[model samples]
Target: MTFPRTLADLSTAELGSGYQAGDFSPGEVLDAVAERIAACEPTINALWHEDLAAARSRAEESGARWRSGQPRGALDGVPVTIKENIARKGVAMPSGHAAGDPQPADHDAPITERLEEAGAIIVGSTVMPDWGMLSSGVSSRHGITRSPLDPALTTGGSSSGAGAAAAAGYGPIHIGSDIGGSIRLPGTWLGLATLKPSFGRIPLDAPYLGRCAGPLARTVDDLRAAMTVIGRPDARDYSQLPPYSGDYRVPDFSVSGLRVAVHTEAGCGMPTDPEVAAAVDAAAQRFADAGAQVTRIAPFMSEELLVDVDRFWRVRSWVDYHGLDIEDQRRILPYVARWCTAGADVPGAELLRCYQSIQTMRQATVAATEPFDLVLSPVAPVAAFPAEWPMPFNDPDQPMGHISFTVPYNMSEQPAASVNAGYTADGRTVGLQLAGRRFDDAGVLAAAEWFERSAEIAAPERTVG
Candidate 1:
């Protein structure tokens, strides 16, 4: 049966209901999604690899199940994109780097395994920066991933393609990873909803500090749905926490009586764009209208903490990249090479010092947030910048300034998300960040849903050719 063009726009829940109601077969939905991807890919560059044939086969199987009076699970037949950094068995996980011999993964990442188990069809692997390092989507291997809302603007990174795919309607659900706001940055710039769940909430095979996998979606409900499936424990990941029993559903509770703190600037002394700040203030007011106790607070980060965190990030990358031979290093992206060199010479004692400072920052953040139910801030100091730039800041000396607000929460290992607050006067998107204490992912998602319902954040008109 032929499906409407809008079939790709359905939320995960809506899509499932439509399948059960026989509105259209899963094959029909897959064909519509393939059309959407073909239409947007040339300009957006959101996907790096696609197996439409495999995806179609999966959809056919799901359609047979639905016709037989049974559906596989919540996400059965859903077209979902996994970020390139995540392994999908038999798919090459180049991660946008040219330095290494690109080998097809022999096993799926735990999250990928779970999503498929829930019957989600893997449509393709999305684009990212080399080593998943940059905040902008410019990659040596995959080219730049532009915003679907405006091709001249960046989609943000290293989950760049996931953001573009989510915004471009490739699907309702996209899997993204965040160490220093990779998911949230792209979500903000692309005008999508994303969650960087508390550390260990989603099991990951990453060896880096502060890295975790989560969902980027068009709606809070979709995020919740994806979380419920991917948040399950995986024995393959040694870092997996004891299984979480907390519900992933957004609570239907009122926003009133919740204590919230609004921070307009980073404690590291980064200045926010006035327009971005205004949007965040307006979001805070929405909470106030809902009877939430909202107070304007200074940023939770300090200059010392920011510096040490930056060092830790650089050294971590240095460790990963340093193992490559000189010839391999030469093939790496220039910006990535610069970051690696910056930390390669650091003494072991200094690295130890950075970890100590990180622990101190974590303690201080937990203490500061203990009294508040939620913390609200701008996801970035500025809206989406030029696609060619590595970051919004022009100075190489201050490369991480734009990520100041979001990265602190990563250090604290807390649950944080980027929600579409509004747009800049120039038509660029701005995101308001919501954070909750560690393991309070539900509260963060619940607050985002309240804002989404109250504000009615609209999806952008297709700007891609």
Candidate 2:
């Protein structure tokens, strides 16, 4: 059984190296990926629309190009899944809602175009919760995605499918869109290395304050490679930053002399579980042992900021939900429907107050961490919950309680990543959030890679069922 390792289980760098050295072709890798998906997808429900036949043809073409020494770009043959929300041409972007368009998209999203142009094979689109709102994988259109670590446990969303697929060995790389803690929350829960790059680092056709697409994989190297492809400039997004001239590779670097701040208390939302806090403390110690100056930081987030942000998002979801016909409106997930209903009667002045609170949060986050070169915190305040729960608290009145640690960075436009830090008492994985100053994606990634090497970053056992 151990005669040969499955190519699907290889890291992105390993797959690319194998391709360059002729150890294996993209077609062979696609077959291996298909095998893995078949074994896991039925139980995990990690994917929605898949055309394996089309993917294999693309892989064959990529393999031929690789053999001819003319691979299209750096990620030439790697198999990858895009979050269901990231539009793919000719594929329906239900985006975890029944109200979403049934017709195929007319054009690819900017990141999708970039990845395809880099010759990456698109495996399929992963599942997500309604409107990519919830932190758990309780999708309406797509069924719940169980964590690969334990089928009974949740895979945090809105990047639910990408996280599950990455942990379950569907491929070496997967792309996800995160606003708030979507990518990092699930990454931690599923024990994957995920990066939610600084806003605009990965261009989005439809950009928002905290929304951006990023990579979730088993290794930082894969994330680095994904950044190389996804970070390319795309004019379609007017909000995207000017082309980044810096390298995307995680530099061979040291954490020595870095000023790193650690925070366990959020001062607002869900309190960090003892086991989760211990894991974060342990990650902080890793920095201390590596000669980095690790210091505890006070919580800049507050109950007002958390509630305001949640309300602001609720209004948004309410608009989208209300626009749907009555039948389609009823089709929304009950949890999401109940949550967004609060926004319907919201006063305009109160909505403006909510927006201002986001500004307060942004300013507070920057001011609090300005002295440090990097920041570390728990990705989520708790460990994995049941797979079927809509969120950690599962309360319509207060659904965003778990995102306090990760949301500030998104509001502040800082580059943040989640590395599988350690485990809870019962052995569920924990993620440590590494955040750097706004636009310092490279620095954040380099430090994450450094920690990735030092930590025991274990992959889940293959028994997903």
Task: Assess each prediction's global lDDT (C-alpha) against the native.
Answer: 0.86, 0.89
The prediction achieving the highest TM-score against the true structure is: 2
Residue 223, candidate 2: alpha-carbon lDDT: 92
The regions of model 2 sitting more than 4 angstroms off are 1-5, 250-252
lDDT of 1 by residue, 3-94 (tens): 23478888898888999999987898888889899888988998989989999999999998888888878899899999988989898988
Error of 2 at 215 (Å): 0.5
Candidate 2, TM-score vs. the true structure? 0.97
lDDT over C-alpha atoms for residue 438 of model 2: 88
Candidate 2, 168-266: lDDT as tens digits: 888888999888989998888988899999888899999998887899998988898889889978888877888887667545677999999999989
Alpha-carbon runs more than 4 Å astray in model 1: 1-5
